[model samples]
Target: MRRRPATPLLLSATLVTLAATLALGSTPGAAAPGTQSAGTQSVGAQSSGARLSSTPAGAGTDPDEALAAARTALGLGDGAQSRGPGQPVGEGNEATMALRDLRVALPQLGAEQRREGEALLARPTDGGDDPVGQGYDSRSKKLCSGNVCVHYVTKGADRPDSQKWVRKTLQVMNKVWDFETGTLGYRKPVSDRSLPQGKNGGNGKFDVYLKELSGQRLYGYCAPEYLVKGNKRLANGYCVLDDDFAKAEYGRKPLDTLRVTAAHEFFHAIQFNYDYREDRWLLESTATWVEERFADDVNDNRQYLPVGQVRVPDEPLDIFSTTFGRHYGNWAWWEFLTQKYGGGIVRSVWKQAGQFKGAGRDYSTKALTKVLAAKGGFSRNYARFAAVNNNPAAFYPEGASWPSAARIANLKLSKDATRKSQATTVDHMSAQNVDVTPAAELKDKAWTLRLTLDGPAAATKPMAAVLVQNKKGAWDERLLEFNRKGRARLSVPFSARRVDAVTVSLVNTSTSFDCWEDQAYSCAGIADHDAAPFEVTAKVFKDK
Candidate 1:
């Protein structure tokens, strides 16, 4: 959301992230039984990373955007880098690219922030003699499992309180590897042969570093250690988690907090092996969703729903807010997807967005649309998704614990004549819900609430759904029709004798985009048809 010069890594990043280890191809993530659309065509899914020439040092002026991005990527507390003991920080996985951006711009920053950025981008090394970092030996002790190695300190302020924590962390990561790679069938993380220590944490397994991140308020983070040269830009990656999930900070079982964070952060390490420069929102939402797949009982990701697309329906679904966590909060959308198409849907979307040999390598939503094309179409199903969010408790299997879609207007009627609601606008892939409740006066069976809609041009892709709830609380759902001019009318029973409430859900399903322009919306492009307007009016009368 900050106005800054697009870095070379970012300008072409929306197209091709890192070089591919395998051959290049843009295809859907997983194979399914339906007619798969190619999704939105990427500019160049197989484009070479060699094309990206780093910006000259301080070529541009503003370093704040680059610095904030770097700190978030490193999980160094966006609000404040330092926190009192036990305070919790958020997670971010795009540190490799973010650090690169900041590294190039460090010359422009003030001394304090510049030193912070330098330390973040530096190799994970700490010695008692080292300045500005956890005082530990240069070589962190490690224990390995099937395909991952856990790195930790034996004695230091940053060391885990118990060595048992080290083995437990290893078990947690091994479980993540088994479920993600063995059970769910996602690719494993690439090896960090070029790890600065000359040791790939014992035999090139995915390395996880344990340090006093809890002091800095970080849960965990994954960063690409080395980007291989190829068209897909596949990279070797590493992760760092808090030395301990202190009970005082997270207010939960240390093991429970550890489970979800490991599941969430490890997915980012896997993502780097797929596409190091993939869309930020896709990278985060899917990672957050994977935590549920790996450890459903923890349900820690639920904390983000208040800021998610379902709870904040007026914002575009793919917009990546640097200050806001909507990117991570929208995990529920993928949950909606998995429950609908079965578990393989997320993998299929990732497959479509992959740059691997048989990968679709399409941009984020493009791959999603392609995967959902067979289920009906992205447009239709997405509109239904908006409707589903209208009452997540009714649609999602685990949604009983989740919040419902936000309502823009709450209209109550006792004996209403006619009320024209305010005209509001919604962005693409977002919605607005209006709840009309009977105020216990209109009890006759003849009473009805007549509703009308005036929307933007049909080309803008406006959609509407009506939910009529009876006294028993059962809902009748249907699509409200509209003409080419975006006008429509419908009527539903509103009598207190039989009805409970009527909800009108308005949707904006526009997918038009100007690719590679703004790095805010889906595909890092600008939404071409954003802020489509709609107005609804209601008249309660008797049909005797």
Candidate 2:
């Protein structure tokens, strides 16, 4: 579940700032959900009035003129715009705020404050006999059954309705938990007998709080407790929800929102039993992804697809920022895993991640790669996953996959004289497309295009490929291999007299590095970094 930003409470105000910004008719930076943006468009779909004939209908024409017209028709200008500093771009709304809370606030809290926060998470402030301080009326009831116990505040006409909705949602949550645990083969956290047990006793029952939260856009979140020493195990985590926000957001069918949120937030509780401090991207992405399995009709996670696909498609999945799009967009990675391998693969990743006592952000990726290598390494699977993302609807062919390829806005690149090349950045499990034309001096002559990639040096480097169309309209792909310095230079030889346009794309193949010499032993070392953007340079010159 995503966290809400800390701000002054405004109960009387309409908290539709995020909803309004996400509405269909919003402006460029604030476009509606699933709408295409400038840089993250679909490769299969061409813009209106852009004529990209598959058949070299006019092959052998002057390459310079043809490329220029193609750029103009596609609405690509001189393309001198900077991709900006390596900051996580966000929609500046509740989701972004939630990311900020997790990425910034949680880490910045002092030792005492962090302990207090964790304590608050383990034992939430129950609204009892103090409405103002607790943020809800003192009247409350605990509904316990199966593996869940819902503590809801009963007040006015909303209490009865809230209780009924929560009861029903718990049934769904339990069913999902049972199925996931059975299929994934994960052990439910052993109940902590020393802690104060609820009505159900120390049976490992998770807690849920339904109350009127302070912030209007608070929604819901999961607060997981870490594993401790002695006879105590990891405390069963709790979930807090803003009932009023759920009602306002869902209108006549507010329970639908509550039901999905319950499934999503409760998964976070389950994840805590594994590794509470796992990578934020993996935590949120898997939590968001599980919502679909329990409640497909309530696509609350869909609101974030375009945020990642259209806004920053090049940003990789392992990016360590609070950008709402990048983190939420990570759901696609899990979806791909479930489809290609099976849901068990996801469980294996979590199981492996939980084994590490103080594993950092790279733990999730390392675990994932380790689990996936048996089928094939992360590099191989990542290449296929990246391709599927470009046009998910076409690749998935399933009814429930996150519709990313249908929505991502295509990236446009133009020749840059200042940089002495056309350049752009690509993220992990993602790709970027650049449109290139030969210089005027080399028109009608044979020339060589040198493509260079500069980025982190991993055991398995990212893949770069050049795609060009032949006279028969077929796209021939040329894969670029890297040298020892982690730089890949591909010399694309072409006759300016024949070829008209060329598209070069850089793809992130692996996100984490493994230091283990053998599978039987623990890793000697691990080098994990966020999905940092890498530069791709395209330089054109006369063939020697």
Candidate 3:
């Protein structure tokens, strides 16, 4: 793994000790069972919207070909027979019975859902109204066997696209839910335009509505419009996407992308189902980690493949500019952390999260630091992702693992103990600063520096600090800057000979103190106690 300026043994040691104490309180779980997690809840199960029903257009009600296909995929012998109410047909797993019953009862659907399903299915199937206008619908009910059943109200010629998606969806679920740890998957018919916008076009997205029954909310782009409309009871619900992007990325043809999306969403589902709500970073990071690590794209389950290349650029700011690199970067962070430690550690944190009304302040940042410290040190976490892609030069000061894509490949990984001089004194600051000193000394070779304020004035008229250094004989300021709540000691390339010493100090660029309402201040003196110092022979490495 790449090596950077190590965090001060004192700071790391302090954090580790604190984390160990904190982890003793952590537990594991997801959202509480009944309270719907953020997003829309499925209320249709309470009452059918249209009050509709279904029947065969002419004679045979059975979808012979579709049944044959489902049977083949299920590996049930072709001789599999359709049993009536009390007749036992096949393996008789509660889940299978739930599925079979759902298939048989699909003709009776509520109005609104059935209408929407028909319209969407109509567009893709390219067929005129069912020869004489016969429609399909399913009765929505919780079976005695205890699985949620959803049937697509069928109308017109059964669209091949819709049928194919339905079969694939069931097939995937049959395998995924084989563990049957409480969550169950079954199709429901819907006429809502939003229904089919998920993983398999209209055939799959409606699962979110079903998720509402289980109380899982949605986030991302789909939040504002659908999730938070003022019903505090429904406060946390919204869709991440109207449709699953993986399917779109697969070019619209029915593909196995739905399986991946199922795993992705269900991971969230399981978490929501369990109320595991502590640190959002741990929650999201772990979800992403599991998605990439568990997603399988091949026909045989033996071979494994990541869903796609980590879209490192798309991640939120904290993960990219601060913690990990980008999309793949964050996943890499969690993946590394999990591999080194174990996933059970996350469950421990999740138990703590559920107790929170909401994760307040820099919850993610603090949580991670605490978790790392509790588990001994951040080195284990760092070592996990950096194991293969070690970079040398820019490793120090922490947060080095999360750089731009271009910088990731050329990472330098080397560890040489050479004496070098650098500076950590406050470079430039005016007298208007508060109680602290204008300058400070930072001796630790650590890269990311964090500072916490003490006084009320410190909190009000906050100060800002920047880490500047000389690179290749010339002075260059990096974009990594911090305010009162936090400070970062950066480790970029430095030159000892060209420059005498680098400085760590406060800079007051803002003149306005009028915004001091939250005990806010724009300028203050820095004590300089923990300001990181410049060094000559620091060790660096690039393992990638």
Against the reference, the lDDT scores of all candidates come to 0.69, 0.48, 0.27
lDDT of 1 by residue, 1-544 (tens): 1111122221121122232432333322221121111111121122244432111112322478878877665545554455555445444244444654464455567766765655554445434443444335545678887778888877766689898999999999999888987799887776543222232443446778887766555677676543444443465567778888887766679999999988988888777656666777888899989988988988888888888877887877887775678977899888888887877999888878776668886778888888988998776777777787877888887777888888888788766434547578888888888988877878888888888998988877788988898878687888865689999899888888898888888888888877766357765577887878888887788887
Candidate closest to the true structure, highest TM-score:
1
Q: What TM-score should be assigned to candidate 1?
A: 0.82
Candidate 1 stretches with Cα past 4 Å from truth are 1-64, 72-79, 85-119, 126-138, 193-199, 414-416
Candidate 1 lDDT trough over 10 residues, lowest sum: 35-44
lDDT of 2 by residue, 1-544 (tens): 1112222111111111223333422222221222111111111111132222111112122323323322222123352121123321112223212321222233344554433232232323332332112333445567778766666656642253545677776675577667555555555542332222331123335566665432323356665332222101122355666454344343425656666666667677666555444555667788778876767677767776765532345666555444244677667678778888777778778766763234222356677878887987777566555545544554453423555333122222223441244445454456665545554344444566666776556454676556664444445566655555667777665455555545555566655444332111112213343354556666665565
Per-structure clash totals for the candidates: 19, 8, 98
Pick the lDDT winner. 1
Name the lDDT value of residue 125 in candidate 3.
18
Question: lDDT, candidate 1, residue 49?
Answer: 49
Estimate TM-scores for all models.
0.82, 0.60, 0.36
The deviation in Å at residue 529 for candidate 3 is: 14
